[model samples]
Target: MSDILFTSSATAKNGRDGHVKSSDGMIDLDLVNPAENKEGKGSNPEQLFAAGYAACFDGALNLVASKKDKQIDSTTTAEVSFMKDKEDGGFKIGVTMNVEVQGVSPEDAEELVEAAHQFCPYSKATRGNIDVKLVPQAIE
Candidate 1:
């Protein structure tokens, strides 16, 4: 069982080529079908999911850093790919989270990223259900 901290709702009309709006009126945007336009004229489900995962993973990293009494001055980029499962006859997603941790040693950063992956809700949710790769990037 889980206790809810907050809840959000959004509705999409006309499928992938339509419009989506959040209940709070914060997110209102038009969606373009990726099939029609590879570089969609507007937002798409894959983009939205990538954004959410990026934010959530960042937060999870921060939380883990705080717990460990460490500070991370970095950013995470989530690259999500949506592809059709030819054999399964449906769509599936692949995710790669590139974590660039600043103010920490490369080894430490790698450790923290692994820990964050373990703690991130999105990671846990997608584990075994999807293919996710966590890549730790060194600060240049």
Candidate 2:
């Protein structure tokens, strides 16, 4: 392991049908499978993953823009889908990140998004393991 920057810990009980709590007590929530969550009462793993990835990617996008001396306001939305895996007869997850960038040209926005995909930790982690689509839009 390289030099540790930080570590986050969370504990989950009863698999996908119970509860999860962070070690820092910042997160405490019920877990429900999306297929079983008819009333939308609790959070699912896919939703959590989407939130994390979106936030991370947005930060990375801002960082990349700053390095290029471009001031940009950006929002990233990560849509995560859980689907059946035909190869293994199991399940897999895919992501589509929609990024809206202001204060930049359309071409620059697209380039920044591409650079963020290469820089973001979450993107790097899921690069070869899953499918991720990046959509960049420039706003006036």
Candidate 3:
């Protein structure tokens, strides 16, 4: 696009009951449907999306805090749900990002999180396409 910073590629085969391997070979894993994965033998698309979003959001939060001259230690947990789309009779995804920030007041933590949502690339990409809820907490 506009001076690409990086690109990542992964290939998935056999749909939900298959294997996924990245171009760099760092993320080779088995794929399983969440509902059918009773034994939890493999990873699902939702799990991978959650992991990427959480890491990106947390980095965005720290960057925002640094710009405001505030130091914060934070962890972001992204809970992704796969559900039916009543509007289109298809499936959809939703995300809830629970962020805990230390070394800041609760109010400040909330503000930082809001700012991060605006800055995070993943949040921007999914802004109008999906539903995302942000919950921020301060660890005093």
Candidate 4:
């Protein structure tokens, strides 16, 4: 029952070590698995997901700041780890978002980041499904 603003589709062949192409042909990247004996080099699903999530979260932070009538210069660094879920017997993702806001107090930056977590679609979708840690910092 939600209004769809936009949708993105991608096709991947050969699982983790393969090629991925988007429906819009904007993203066509070769994937390489880092778990192999050979050191293959290329992009991976986790990296892509982390990039997308970081950008989306930053956008959400900006939205919240705007609503609060505050001007913030911020940067979001997301570190995503892919690990084995011992309980689930499969792989899972863990996200740590390091957010730095310039010209803002640490308390205000923390508040903005918390509000962003509530507003970000990625955060909403991953809530309760993954472990996400938000670290807010203020830069002078």
RMSD vs true structure, all candidates: 1.4, 0.8, 0.8, 1.1
Give lDDT: candidate 2, residue 122: 99
Tens-digit lDDT track of model 3 for 1-140: 58998889999999888999999999999998978768768998999999999999999999999999998999999999999999999999999999999999999999999999999999999999999999999998
lDDT of 4: 0.93
Candidate ranking under lDDT, highest first, comes to 3, 2, 4, 1
Give me the runs in candidate 4 sitting further than 4 Å from their true place: none
Whole-model lDDT for model 2 versus the true structure?
A: 0.94
Pairs with steric clashes in candidate 3: none
lDDT of 4 by residue, 30-69 (tens): 9997766247878898889999999999999999999999
Name the candidate, 2 or 3, with the larger lDDT value. Answer: 3
Query: Each model's C-alpha lDDT?
Result: 0.89, 0.94, 0.96, 0.93
How does each model score on TM-score?
A: 0.93, 0.97, 0.97, 0.95
Q: In candidate 2, how many Å is residue 20 off? A: 0.9
Lowest-lDDT window of 10 residues in candidate 4? 33-42
Top-lDDT candidate index: 3
lDDT of 1 by residue, 105-126 (tens): 8888888899989999989999
Q: Cα lDDT for residue 111, model 4?
A: 97
* Model 1 bad stretches (over 4 Å): none
Question: What's the alpha carbon RMSD for model 2?
Answer: 0.8
